[model samples]
Target: MSLAELIDQPEFGHHESPRHQTRRVLLLGNDDRVLLAVARGLGRNGISVDVAWCDPDSPALKSQYVHAFHSVVPYSPHDDQWLDGLHRLVKQYDYDLVIPCNDYAVVPLQLEREKLDPDTHWYLINDDAFQVAFDKAKTSRVASELGINVPRECEITDADVRSGFSNREFSLPDRRSLRFPVYVKPRSSITASDVTNKRSAQRVDSPDALAEYLIHEFPHDGVLIQESFSGVGIGVEILAHQGKVLMQIQHQRLRETIDGGSTYRETIAELPELTEATRKLVQHLNYTGVGMFEFRYNRETGDWVFLEINARFWGSLPLAIAAKANFPFALYELLVKGQTNFHTNHTIGVRCRNLINDLRAFRHQKAEEFDLENLLFGKDYLDFYAPDDWRPQLATLVHFARSVLGKFTRRIGFSV
Candidate 1:
């Protein structure tokens, strides 16, 4: 059956018939690339997409895919006030699904589930699951419990801060036998925010440097200190419904924006290790939602060590779509149609190029190692620049133009 025919069945839950249900998704965080990709994907499936954002003049507001736009003051999703606004919005229009694009929104949205209509679906990993997913320390504990291979780590909380240069400090941990080049990062943080709640990490070669960094930088709200693993990065994206994994795909990172972050990037090819770990994690969590599991292929053991799971839809979704596992459509089926015949094994050979980071990766590669063909025409990763639709694409173009003009006008002493 055609995808539309499958989704239109009575068992899928839309009594309004296919045409009426086609355009009924409400998307939060309108500016997020994942939301845009999700919206575009849903729109393609005959779903009408509406957007709400703190920034009304968001470039997304102009998208033809978006049916209506709501202006909201930027507020942390963690706050109760944001939930109140969401409740009011829900009362006015029954949004079939609520998708949070950033990490900061994941926890609060999950916790405040009671405020939403019972019939309205949200695809976040459960609250307890999210606590583990968002916090590195908690994730390490859970992985150990689940027998998943991961790094050994400890969390340094605000209480860990101690006074003076005393040898009897309560905050210090015995690091005599721990491996050198240990990695440190925040145990918890909100979206696009400061890296350190109060403390930062400097890779320490000696015990004194570790002690000094902990004493100085991590007088902390939250931070994680763990053994560093060397490996090729791989990501597995999946969709779960009723706690069952419905679709899965794995992709290797050919480039990254940060040393260990997914700010922007592209894919190389599907990695077997990443695909397996993604399945293992979703099974362990008994999770129901759109999730991505990241793994670092440890060179030391020649195995992929579980890193952390994004308990919500992720940033590189377009790449996943281009690579042949369209998670957004799978999610729409679950939320709108409640369909379960959701299995696929499509793969797109993706390569993200022209992005600032991908450009850097290209420059880093030696001439003989570089393949110039994929750079010109996308071999794998989806570039926001390439669009199947003209309206949202034009909207993005105008938005980018205004951004450049705003910067130029500021340089010329004009107030924006």
Candidate 2:
């Protein structure tokens, strides 16, 4: 049987026949602002939600938007214990859907599909989904296969790590023809967070520098060397249903914590080509969830090469929600209503805000990153904690206070 089919089989002991029904959904990766926003969106739309994560300060735990909250060690979604936990939680609550808002959470959940409630459907892609999106080498290959534009690249392996940085016959010698100033990234075993701390990657201006990076910094294997694309980085958020894209929202980074790093200030954009390209790629993958496609514009090549695909909800979700393309609501509709008769027609303006308190390190490095005016008074997106409901609004304030106190204590001598 195919991987998607195998993973899609009902595991709750019975099936509900995919009917339009109000659902009790579980949201994972709790402390994430994106996940909190998703839960708020779903809750506002009347879908009951429960939250689980490792952090005590998970806003979902204290937020009025959630039905219940659980804190525990974040186990590998691939681990049987994780599956057991999921099964127990779903059985205990009789949840009908599981919505994961983080990439790490999605992969393991997809791997252990047999543990999910059969009555529950997951708003996620399958193992092949990870194969196509998260793994950079595989993503490039698959994009190339579909005639989708990707960087010309070569993979570096463990053998390359053992050998000194010499272009010998044992190595893929065909990379000799590639031009200088190529971008070298680890094929696997590294993440965005690694790039900030590790001196592994180098902007090699020549083959010697590439060899140097390989010898000293990038000693680990599973790397990729690709033609560097330098352009204004734009991200596209998409909601897809069984290979069809239902909504697309684009954003252009105004500023970020690190040069050529993740965004701290972004504005909604209108890019038809990006939207269409992301739509086509997801359709080919038969994606049935929320996803983001990150692309870097290469001024030299004048092409937008595919960078990565985030298979779950993305960071700038409130921006999309403000623009009327509500991903969380859409996922809820798919699981509960089965279809939404709604159409988005809102144009959310620019926004700039701090990353969630849990992302303290990022926010600390870039505390003054945002345009204060835009962050404080933007009419575009609603602040996650600034609820219109008085009760919930107070709860949000309390959550913020606790988060600040926790960070303050951590700053002193206490470990967070």
Candidate 3:
């Protein structure tokens, strides 16, 4: 039966549709790991999947399940170059949905959802809500309003940003109260107009360094200075629609970089307090799609502090899928089929690793850093490698070789 015919039937997601007719999906703006994880799940489920990305060397391109590849700009503010390409893809082909992978694409899609047909299953949100989730300052406000526990924060005002710190002077009233060694993060990941990359929060150890850091990043709006917490990283992965949460999964870091993103993690059923906080935050935003409410948790005499939110799919997506959460398929069913086949419970203590990054982190352990021992060997559901889909294994090696060569050649003063 034709896809249109099959979809119109009452039992689309049911077992009746054999060789399920084309339900074309486009995965865009997600990083390599997330893209591969999502693509593999949906493709295996009889969806015709295409990948559109800005990076040529992305590992997702080598996935055996991908039907086709296209190059597209990640985001554009003043022009429709990126938007136009996306429009053509959806219009030319009756794509079931376009899943945005990261903030770079989510920001633009949220800003221009009307052009993309607001009624479609584009996995988008209104710009106002995006601000609350994407902007740290706004997230703090909303989290606090929801009575979710969040870290102590200090705001950087417009007047402070307007007064250039190049002269090494900017007014910070909270500086006296703030304990040294705090985190200074851009209010939003897309700090600059260009949206070049997902911005990183840095640790500034002292007042002079903090001033210098702000001076360097002067023009970007609303940089947040927050109290740093030393604790284990926790992620509450959730999927919601119109303020109703569908499914929630929890994972805690086994090994993580000093900044963010865990290289090695295992699904864990942690505190119920965090679960309550996550549900409140998602419902408060009336969040309309998949999101990860990231937190930092202290063991004793403290609880989960709302760190930030990933308004899209997260890097540890593979781990979630391995735990049988299957977020990609769940999201697809919710958007395309108009109903979610919920996985009532996700497996706990299922460890997953990004082998490459884990090894890199171990190789270059910094001074006074947590040692990574016996982590290099792991058979527990590798992130980039699948037993059936082994193409990424070769593609990843070639890409890594090129990256290392480029770095080495640059040291000798030449671009590879």
Candidate 4:
């Protein structure tokens, strides 16, 4: 039978002998891919999954593993109505746990943990530590103090803000200090409520480009201007309870978007430097739940520079699951079962691709380092095309087409 047909089969959630208890989990995030992966991961392990998202047509809604779906206020820094809605859902459904899958959702929940139902368990870092992690500048300073390598950064000045697209050429305190091709990004990873065009990071080749971006693109926003590191992006995903790490998995980005987001990545054996750095950071924060520490591996120096910590499930979570890390299930066990037999070891060299976004990368011609031949013929795990749950894959295609059409219509002065 086809995967779609099998989604409705009676045996979908009827495991003969369940490994984990049947606890209802409410997952929060708009990223359907991450939601779908978590749903399947926990659902198959005998946990009931419910999803709350802003988009009604999200692919996670189509997953058979999701017992219920609810539309809540979209992720925003200032909005707290979603919390009220979530409280009602928790009271109504008596969900055993609440999991926020993105930083946008994670931060708000962390800030208002007291407002949430005390009976409902949520694994998250404390607000004080999260504050340090959320801000790039603060994170870099803390990591550096901890004896971890971090990209050199300069403080933004009031003069820089006042310059604001002026004719006067702007210059840094130490003009010769920074190498060319530095990155200019928001000081804090969280997007401001008033900001319309949100960006992760921008690479600026010249000082002129850097000044122009800060003045024009994000005039009112606080930004970090840092010396860009030349290296490959590596993510070390860890699941911790209190101050102790339960599991850690490493993945190397093979290809990413033009700006800087992983599209293709593969599981790799843990490196001592990367592993040690991650442990130090996580322990320092006394973080609970799942977090991924991103690093830049300088090929020439063999040094690992700490980037930032994502205090929630990351985009490439499915890749970790595909390599047998099973973070979602591990999280469920930790939060609900009170203990877990968490395993850190995972199969190395197992590649995982987000096919839809990979296509976007291919369209932009950005992933030059990726071998087209390997993408075509090599054995790999696909994020969306799961054998037991194929409908989300189809949903992804439809969503992509609709998005492209929407962009086209807007360009041509039409509306869809």
- What ranking of all candidate models by TM-score puts the best one first? 3, 4, 1, 2
Q: Could you give candidate 3's per-residue lDDT for residues 1-416 as a string of tens digits?
A: 85333322221112222233678787886588888888888988888777775475566766766776777765667787877777766666557888888766667777777777554468776566687888888998788888888777788866875665565433345455677778888888774366666678888898789787776664457688887787888999988887788988888887776676688888987578988898888777777778888999888766668888888889999999888888888888887778854755788988888877876765565425433343444447778888777666556766677689998988888543
Error of model 4, residue 270, in angstroms: 1.1
Candidate 1 lDDT over residue span 164-230, tens digit each: 4345222225453556566667666553243112232345565566667777766345677676777
TM-scores, in order shown?
Answer: 0.77, 0.74, 0.86, 0.85
What's model 4's overall lDDT? Answer: 0.76
Count of clashing pairs, candidate 1: 15
The C-alpha local distance difference test score for the whole of candidate 1 amounts to: 0.61
State the displacement of the C-alpha of residue 171, model 1, in Å, after optimal TM-score superposition. 12
* Candidate 2 residue lDDT tens string, 243-340: 88776677765544432444443555566777777877897888877788988765466678777787878776766665566788887776566783
Model 2 worst lDDT window (10 residues): 6-15
The lDDT values for all models are 0.61, 0.63, 0.75, 0.76
Q: How do the residues 293-347 of candidate 4 rate in per-residue lDDT, one tens digit apiece?
A: 9999977889768888887888898898888888999888887778856656689
Alpha carbon RMSD to native, model 3: 7.4
Model 3 TM-score relative to the real fold: 0.86
Cα lDDT for residue 122, candidate 2: 70
